[model samples]
Target: MDDAHRTRWTRRTLDWLRTEVGSALLLVGVVLVALAWANSPFSGAYEHLWELPVHVDAGDLRFDMDLHHWVNDGLMVLFFFVVGLEVRQELAVGALRQRNRRLVPLVAGALGVLTPAAVYLVIAGRDAPTGWGVVIGTDTAFLLGVLALVGPAMSNQLRIFLLTLSVVDDFIAVTVIGTVYSDDVRPGPLVLAAACLLALWLLGRAREWRSTPYVLVVVVLWGATVQAGVHPSLAGMLAGLLVPAASPEREDVVRAKHLFRSYWQSPNAGVARVVGLGLARSISVNHRLHEQLRTPVSLVVVPVFAFANAGIDLRGGALGEAFGSTVLWGVVAGLVAGKLVGISLGAWAAVRAGLGELPDGVGPGSVVGGAALSGIGFTVSLLIADLAFEDEADTQAAAIGVLVAMVLSSLVGAFAFRVARVRFGEHSADLPVTLTPDVDVERDHLRGPAGAPYTVVEYLDFQCPFCARATGMGQDLADHFGDQIRYVVRHLPLEDVHPQAFGAALAAEAAHRQGAFWEMHDVLFANQARLEPDDLRGYALELGLDVERFDRDMADETLAERVRAHAESARASGAQGTPTFFLNGVRNQGSHDARTLIAALEESLPEAAVRRRS
Candidate 1:
């Protein structure tokens, strides 16, 4: 990942968090309104409204359901579908793609699921074992919202960890719903549903891009699943899983760009449609659907589901009875205590076993706080309560339990973060802000006068497209500042994403041996599409260096070590992705455009110089 891509990802993540937080606040308000209406003089009306029968009949396709059932069994499919889309994307290219990255969260989330059920079983003690699944899920919206409210100011790493864990939790919860909570299966419809799913698989295998086909097939699959005595929502998840997800290919992007340019020149309906389709095809179906559905799922489906389901009447001593009910206490203890212990223990064990490490800047305390917040199981918990219990009283008890767990979990998470800050002195919530091992004019690659008043350093990947765009910024800044600016470039090649990057970094080091480092740098960035060993050798030969010496230097372990050391220094300086810039000793936190770089460099100058520039 380059800095531009990483920055966009970070911005998207923050945007997602904000959206989820707003959705959570809306869900919370809806829940409160529901509770108020349920307990108010219009209590009967509340029940009557949801219980109102809704019927849909279309040429032998007959359906009869209450308003509540329509929301749960129908509209909520979109919710599960969106969740499945996210899971597929993550497994394909997002955070969960790497096994090492998935390890800690996978273990922690699995334990987080099981431990809660165990707690529920122990506490419920033969009273309501069927309700154990209620505690298995963490409501991601509410969890994120609560984390925002109680967690440290800069908690990007912790938020990412918790989000990954929550995704795992959701996957498990849906699996349990499909298998454990569904009605008895029927052979004929089961086979039909299987056939429909097979059709979905075929569509995926064919890499179908049109949404209409997928939507129609998924709807038919849902009906088949319902008839098969499976949860229809599971069909949604399964359908979503079958949708192909992959990063956009460079060729596809270039084609889309060309199509857009054509549309810009033509400005007609035919050209516009071509551009739209081209741009849509540049992204995966999974991403396209996720973008289209996430807002509706978050803003409407979830809130409507809450309104329909969460209106439990706490009248006639129901609240007092809930306090005494084992089911209520079971859910509360299961989520609040079990999640904390299980997540912490699982993470600790994973680290001990060398399975995976926590995200950078996340500590034991942050883990604990995140674990506590994992107890907030509002949405899916309520759904499970509806599925698990036949008795209304037990269901109400579980709902109350979920509400109480949410409050207790929030308080516990707050306390844990507070303790982490005060007692442990783990105050900083972001990665290190200062550059490590200050730039050395003698040791570093310098582009201008060594004694320049203003200094700019960049940790860069040679194969990264974003870094390639930034390659000329050094010369631009030098031009703008005359000899007053010194530009330093350090290798931080991201080998996982950019496989050719490490070798390219080594090529640069080899070129440095022949005093043509900048020449080789420009060539490599220019020919980013070709950075193999032969390409590097050809570029070296074109630079008029002794190819023999360059080859010898490229083979030197010292050059590789030098590159690795620079990567380590990049990490230490909070540069997770390249090209990461430092103005003076501080990390640059703005855009990487040459104009922006020039302005930032001007600001980094001495006060007198800055004033003169102003």
Candidate 2:
């Protein structure tokens, strides 16, 4: 794709992943097409096409597998790698980063796995106990998609809970695939695979940021895994784990902007290439791969896998026999009934034991609904079903069971959420939507004209380096719009991470008493590393403020409370990090770059004003 198309597709894909309904519908459509083609006169062609041999040969190495194996072993590697990236991200900075926030979901997820496996074994022990792993996973794509369709109007809290739970499920599912379901052991190749994995670890430890090195290593690792007779999915996941995934550092962002400015001034291929590479390097490789790969994997790789695997020929009494067998009912009960009970009871027990509390807005009914939706286990469930059962009839039965469970679980979840809304009156389980306690000129420290037509409000922590960089971007916006834009900054001192932030906010407020708030603001951002009490006092002296009055005001409890109030307002406005922006009272969804923010401001202006400005 061209850059424009690529950008648009990536944005749409992220939105679909976030909202979840579109991708699920696409998956469902693909599955329907597969079934239709399988049952049609072209049915014979379906199996024949996938069974065609694929061959790969190197100078002294050769590998051969059918198209089906290629899909399972090859393209699916990207899917698992993306999953691993997400898991790593969660562990680093997402929901699971906080120990207390992660505890309840971890407990519930573990139980969710065990309970389903237990239920499956109970129902199908004598017949197909090995297939218990089939029900141990929840397909994140389908779960989120169906949840969006059937969940509460505002389900962010519950969504985070379920997403966190799925991370655990994914971990166990991949472990089972690699160990419990691998082919016969091959020690020499397995040893080589281990060495490759160690190399990956070493690269990460050494902070190797280049994507090319990681890619080369992963390719060799996958080949070793295939030769080792272990499932390559595990190799993919392990490689992903070793790929660093960190948020962009402020210094790196500033460097990227500098590189861009050089390219802007020179406008040559070499500088453009340098600028591109610089921008890419600012973002972690793991995050970049996830963003670029998730869409194609969801839309293409997964649908192809489904088409290859989900084509069950259920004619000639096959459908009746499949349903009649214990395997089908075992999967149904294990996923649908077991997941609901296990997750619900697990969450309850965790809360009772004070392990951790549920996310803020998720009520019990929402949890119940989310747990039911978790039963929609399609992708990994089907993969496990194929590995768990050698008998074609057994696999067919399990596949039918999965499809049936998806429909049933969706219905059950919808019913639960409906009951939640109507009976318990629990609705809107997400963060506050609009800017809370709308900005006032008298209250907020404002830049630009007081009566400016356009407004941009930023929630910032004085000690946050990102916030420091954002100060320049804010100035750029002010420069572009001049008196037409009013810029406001609210204190959102993340005291846990930025210890001196609260004190700095109070210092700014104290300076406001001497008509030097802007002076202190510029000084604090400029010298973010030194924000101790003594440093604040020094800054007041530097700003020509009355030192006695400033120190007394900084000591005032009411100033501290004002800072606290601003922090509370930031939270109420759904800002969890520094440098969150609100444009014309609406939250900015993506980047807060001057260009993007300027475009938004121009769009909001009257047509006559915009034309005149242009």
Candidate 3:
């Protein structure tokens, strides 16, 4: 297929995934089917299915694995690649971008991992040291699903905290699997693997811009890692790390847009193809690959893995023995008790040390609930169990523990969250949420007619992806409602998490001085990963602003203070995260996507509130 066709297909696939939340549901269904099949009279058929031999032979090169191992080691490589991309993006642009913001989660995740292992050792004794890695990870998919089901009534900051904590722990767990679990290291293959990694990094730094060499290197690196007795899956993470996470250079973006515009006017197929490819390249490699791969890995690969691995039969003696076994007790205690106490205490200590603060509208109790939620560790936990226990009986016992811990942890978290809700009442959630002060046509950023019947006060961070999406939706709403809606913008730069956010907010504020706040907003969101001082100044110059005045305004303490004051006001008014919108003085619930928000506006406002677009 041609480049344009491929791009269109990829975009459609990603769009579909965004609109559907079927992955977790599908995984659950597959697990249920696996369980039924395993306990049926045809249980031998289910067991034999996974043990069926698979082999590849090509001259001196050969590989052999059972169906189950292939699913774990071969198919799951894609899943790990997507994970690596996520971690890379977080470090480059998301919550982990700042060292101080990362510190709390770092501490929490370390303690979460260590405490669980420690608990496992204590319960199972030194004889079971090998299985101690079983309780180290959080199931991101399941946890995020639970949070979504619980809704935005909970503090959004808690969700972010849990997400960051899980991501850090997942990376650490992957590292442990790669290094600690490997049976032996072959020196020659290990050295070659190191060389391959170095070459990949150098190629990325040199901006080779071609995929052929990178793909070859990745294939070789995976093989080398496998030969070295390390898990080959680590190669995916190494490759993802080498991917550049910044937007393309300013010149490159300009050139690509120019080429696209030229092709638009002339209608040349060849020029259009080249422009398509160039536009694709303008996006970061990590983001591009992530967008393409996330849906397939989640929907197909993950469910397939669960179907193969989640089929432990609960026969008469097996179930009773597993319940009685020390290994099972260790797994349960490690994941349930260990994660809850460890993460909660870590957060508490972080606050005591002044290293971290709780999310607005969330208290210490809610944090403990969030800690309980962290105990649901199925995906990565199963992986560790498989690697740790070579004996079939031991592995089955460990699996039973993981399954029970997952269910118990989920229930405990839900119950704790309920308790927090009842105890804190309005304190646990943003209640009677109202618009932050300083949201005004005269004082703050404004879009659309000031006298319009509908007013949306958006507390936004210039660096946030969701806020960027909300900004675009705001534009569409303006176009849809004509002059019947007014948009107000307030700065709530999550500076601690997003390092460039404070500076970006300042730049927009400075541009507002030159009557170009919206122009600067567009530039910053379009190039979020490339928002250094020089880039901000260059954007001002490109937009025909006085460079000297823009720089002076950005550096002005009063302007910065104004932005900070607005942020503080937002926090006081119960804002937990960015892109929070208040429509007519009431918080907007649900997603801010164009369709959803438009319907919400229609319901919230009167029939005569909007003027239909001509």
Best by lDDT: 2
lDDT of 2 by residue, 1-614 (tens): 89999999999777765447888888888889888888889999998999999999976667799999999999888888888889899888899989889999999999999999999999997898789999999999999988888888778778889999999888899999999999797998899999988998888788877788888988998998998899998998888877878988878888998999999899999999999899988998888878888888888898888888888887889899999989999999999999999999999999999999988768898899999999999999998998999898999999999999989989999999999999998786666657888989889988888888999998999988776244478778877888899889899999898999999999999999989888889999999989999999999999899999998998899999899899889888888888888887877767878999999878766784768798
Q: What is the lDDT of candidate 3?
A: 0.79
lDDT measured at residue 551 in model 3 versus the true structure, 0 to 100? 88
- RMSD of model 2 against the true structure: 3.4
CA lDDT of every candidate: 0.87, 0.88, 0.79
Model 1, residue 283: C-alpha shift (Å): 1.3
lDDT of 1 by residue, 24-134 (tens): 777889999999999999999999999999998867767788999899988988988888888888889877988888899889998999899999999995998899999
- Candidate 3 residue lDDT tens string, 482-568: 888888888888876689989998999899899999999888888878899999999999999999999899889999899889888
Which pairs of residues have clashing backbones in candidate 2?
A: none
Off by over 4 Å in 2: 1-19, 468-471, 599-614
Number of the predicted model whose TM-score against the real structure is largest? 2
Clashing pairs in 1: 3-578
In candidate 1, stretches whose alpha carbon ends up further than 4 angstroms from where it belongs are: 1-18, 428-430, 437-458, 470-488, 496-499, 513-515, 578-614
Error of 1 at 306 (Å): 1.6
* Candidate 2, residue 557: lDDT: 96
